[model samples]
Target: MEWAPVCAEGETYANKCMADAAGAQIEYEGECENYFTKEQAQIAAKKWLEEESPTFKFDGIPGSIKYIGYESYTCFGCFGFTFTFNSSHAGYGNRSGQMLAQAIANHTILVQTRGKNVSYALTDGAFDELRQIFICPAISALIPVCGTDNITYPHPCPAMQAGVKIAYEGECQ
Candidate 1:
């Protein structure tokens, strides 16, 4: 059965009719953003990673992939997702020993629809306000850090990329 949420109270009903009976205005489709889980985040990232790999040339092998952290933003008919992950393939290359070991980077993907077409993309620079939104640069040192938000960032760069303040030298407590 399809479910609907009374967003104001964070309540979910079996269906829209049940929600309407409760005199609650339907917020939107599916679960609220806070309900999104780490597993779902990894699934979204993996799906897009597969679909965009040909164009993006991602070299990470399947078993070597690990998700560090993610953030999702939703509005009206559009959504944006940002994730930081590591792959044994090492996203950045520097011809040095450690540099060739692993790669940590942030990737942002967006969803938007116009008419009947739905697009999942790295960025939509078409809009003036979104010009600054971009995939973080592919280069990063292997320095992992904890952000003030209590999330572990692969490195300070990705934490900065997400605008999260660095809290310390290692994983969050």
Candidate 2:
């Protein structure tokens, strides 16, 4: 909880909308360029500048998010962070359940850095800080992919970032 001081008192939120995936086409305002690997980030940025958009999406490769665009980057860095979007903040409660499912399928995320290596934990509280200040703005700056199969925009939208699989039990009716 390194960024605990920097983050707002409440960072996690519960859905107040729906239990299905989002169907509305929410377009990101700018572009999202992060690298789970340095080389890939470089490559993505280059392509983004030339093409004018980040096309990175999560590949359904266990812990992989897909990156797409009209171009490429010099490098995507090294994988060590789990990326996710906090839907509660996005105000997609009605579409929560479905969005969660789509997120699991896409798995887009960026690599967390530590000085010069991948730390993979929110030690400095970068994630929390981003949640309070950076997340929504970041999403607003990028384009949201239509389907939840790939990681679009800033990636791993807080709504559906990659993380440990949650174990759920059937509700007793």
Candidate 3:
């Protein structure tokens, strides 16, 4: 199964003015989600893997998912282009929320159809998937997004904190 939070790579992804700083558009297909923090992105990958696995044969090969971000920065002039996954701009209504994609199907399932000038992403069922995986309460997992956990999805994955084993809260990506 594949999943990704749908996004248009244009028109100032975050709440910036209509002007896209880069004056360039970039869109993504397949499993993807943007997050301000490396921890948040890893959390999302883990969530998606857990949600998608039961439907597929995700065993010794791989189970959960995770990611480590490289360094990125931008002023308001280019923040939108660089930060497409920020909660303030993505589907989440508030900046306090994090951008996450729980897997359902691949890119084919993310969009219903391409519109005249716009394409839409289908993220309505993510909350339901989160409920299914966590089983009790989504946030109840003792794992903190930034700590060292042997339980990371897709074992032997990306190195965290500039090649250090422990991941940090900010600036990894």
Candidate 4:
């Protein structure tokens, strides 16, 4: 007997494969919600952080974790959430200063605001590097250098290393 595909929303498909391809839950009988709870969001964020850097420690307070809510921007609908807390860097030598170190350790959860889809992955490439930039105290002292992309770098050296052209001195602001 051929089995028909039934989605959580009671939508039927031609076949199980087709329903699966459409991102529908196969043989799922429970109700589905389009929203995620704060707890669920926290778990997703934590899991992503762990996967990214196993040694990284999130030294946030007991109640520091929160769901800052979501906003729509861009094609995939970017949603942002953050958890503020001090991070512990017992093993890795502190590259960024204490203030920047703490900030770097903090968790910034970014996700696509799609229905019931929680991506536990840091999709932003510059996130890690930008966080490091915040840690560099020399950034304030270094002359601002503009790259070919119009991004302001703390120093010309970094701009050159990043393979970007220096437009001018002084911060990119």
> Which candidate number maximizes TM-score?
4
Error of 1 at 129 (Å): 19
Q: Estimate, for each residue in 18-38, the C-alpha lDDT of model 1 and write its tens digit.
A: 777788666655554443343
TM-score of 4: 0.34
Candidate 3 lDDT, tens digit per residue, 1-173?
Answer: 22333233422244222123445343433222332243443343334333442222222123222222222223111110111111112221111233334433321112111211111222222321222221123333333333244323221113221122434442223
Tens-place lDDT digits, model 2, residues 92-171: 21222433443332223343442233333231222322232223234544433322333232333442333212222222
Query: Model 1: number of clashes?
Result: 3
TM-score for each candidate, following the candidate numbering: 0.31, 0.19, 0.18, 0.34
Question: lDDT of all predictions, in order shown?
Answer: 0.46, 0.29, 0.27, 0.45
- In candidate 1, where is summed lDDT lowest over 10 consecutive residues? 124-133
lDDT of 1 at 79: 32
Task: State model 2's lDDT.
Answer: 0.29
- What are the clashing pairs of model 4? 144-170, 144-171
lDDT of 4 by residue, 26-128 (tens): 5443333344444554555544443333223334334444455555433222244443323443212123333333333445444433333444223222233
Model 1 regions more than 4 Å off = 1-17, 23-38, 55-58, 61-64, 76-81, 84-119, 123-173
Clashing residue pair totals per candidate (backbone < 3 A): 3, 62, 3, 2
Give candidates' CA RMSD values in order: 13.7, 22.0, 19.5, 9.8
